[model samples]
Target: MDAPAERLQAADAELQEIDERIAEIGRQNLDAVADAYKEFSAVLDRYEDRATDRDDFQGYIEFREQMAEVLGSIPDDLPHRDAFTEADDELTTGVTSVLKHANFDRARSQLEPAREYAELRSREQDVQGTYRDARSALQKEQSTLETERNELERLKRLGEADLDAPVSLLREPIEAYNDAVAEAFDSFTHAASARAVLDLVAETTAYPLVEYRPPPENLHEYVHESAVGEESLSRLLDLAGYSSSKLDHYVENPQAFRSNVATNQSYLSGLSATPLQVSWPPVASDALGWHMRERIAVVGRFATDEVVALARAVRDLGLRDDYERLRTSATARESLSETDRTRLRAGEIERDLTTHRASLDSVREILATYPPLGRR
Candidate 1:
């Protein structure tokens, strides 16, 4: 009976110790679960705030797009448009900054919860859900903003059309004037006949009569000079008459109308010659119309065929001059003998061919004295 009692007491003591150890583990697990719950709640709050901010940001973006569309349709509403654009930019910056902070805060909160839960060996999927929610909210807001921005850009271009009608009206006469002027000067370089020059002058002046009131006085002088040669100034000459004096005048001063011609012709004789600079006139009117003012409207008209022929003639003359120069250079080069050529090839012809014969002779003598290495 004593042995049995002792055995029962030992069993009871062992059971109590096991129970105490189990209770301690349960307390530790509960504390760990409490900490994890706190972390999870913090992460959830952060994610919720981020979602709210993302929604707010998306609302601002939508508002911006609406404002842009309304303002873009009304060109008269530029001040409003600028305000909306600035507001949109501010909202975007604020939203982006808040979202970044929220993501970091949420991620940090979730990480702590994840670590606690991992230690507890439970609920990893719940923490992963929080991370996914944060990312999804961010992507949704970004996508909405991008789509709205694209729509706003389209509206902005549509707004530009309002200025088109008035601008087009203002530019038409200016363009015509520029084109007429360009044609006038371009024709002047190659005006083969007095009539051709006069036609160009007329076209440049917007087809004004040759004796039209308010004629280009400076141009009149050039034409008269071209028409009358060294003969006496005769107002008695009929308008239709072409005299020997007139022919002689053209022969003497083909470039008398230089100022009336294009500025580039000073460098080349032809209308079709490549200009040294391929620059356009500053105003389209300068290229199209000879006269900018409406009061002085009657401008010139030259024959296109005549202008082209003159251009060809000028080019032919230039080519002829080039050919002559080339011929002269070739003649000079060939005057040198084969010995001279050898010296030139060897870079021994320092002076002219006449002064370099000795060096050439030395080269020949060396070649004769020493047969090629292989032959020897």
Candidate 2:
């Protein structure tokens, strides 16, 4: 193959390789999102089940107590009078036992009035007074049951409150994002084609980028993310542009910048596992904190220079690939709306890339003990 053809062949291969890697990373993230959904659903189901049981038990207790009261109202001449008598104080005794354990002082106070009536009946000192006293005591007991029942109802309602609302809200937007990307990638093929997609991305003055592939600790093991504070600069210092601690040999030769596939995969895995490390949702304030944490995956954004750096590897191979440096030709400019032109010039996306430091810190606080991604 001639030199130009050889370079084209290489560009075609490298472009395909990079595109596939990025797509696979997206797939992994989507899977994570799906897993998170199942976990959320399971938690809510358990809570709802418990609440339902409590309501059912409370309803049955209320019905039984009501029937006993109706039977007691019948005259002693009725066939059911004896049955009513047997159950007369059973409900009261049960309530008393519960209150005694739950609130001993109140149970003791209520028992005093009821006990006085029983003593009066035993002594046979005017049965009329005993009747009046017993009625009074029954009224007090009813009040206590009402209060306890109402409280239980309130707690049950609170437990079943709009807990699922927030989870749904967070996931919907992310799913929409994943859907859009999937459709877009349907057309991303060779380097020349990939460059077109990058051009569309470049036009976005404000876009999200998940800063994946945190740099290796040494050339041997991956370290911090390159997009993080001072990390990008550190990457540039890696002698050969690719974040390797090794010596340069590549300022002139572009091929030195591309690292092996294995290292790239390992780094992507670690960074993708944590959403806070990426570059989107802009700033991390209370206003934005909740929604920002929901992000499952984001593509890494590149500046004009960075894109050019990658483009250089291909361009230097032989023929100049103008697509590397970001096309600002009138044709490219006209492709975007006037609003996008303004956004691009303002460097809104780049500003957002660095603005959310505090937000990321807040997330780290929660993940200390319970990792969002389980063990790994």
Best by lDDT: 1
lDDT of 1 by residue, 50-85 (tens): 444644766445544543453344334322233333
* Total backbone collisions, model 2: 6
lDDT of 2 by residue, 1-376 (tens): 2232233334444544544643754544433333333332233233333322434565435544554445444455532234334433333455423312222233233334333333333333333333334333434444554555454343333333333233322233334444443332332212222223333333332324332333443332222222111233223334333543333333332332344323344342232223322122222223233323222212223223333333223223222243212222322333445654455457643343333333333333323322222241
lDDT of 2 at 315: 22
Q: Estimate each model's TM-score.
A: 0.16, 0.18
Looking at candidate 2, what is the lDDT of residue 104? 26
User: For candidate 2, which ten residues in a row score worst on lDDT?
Assistant: 221-230
- The 10-residue segment with the lowest total lDDT in model 1: 273-282
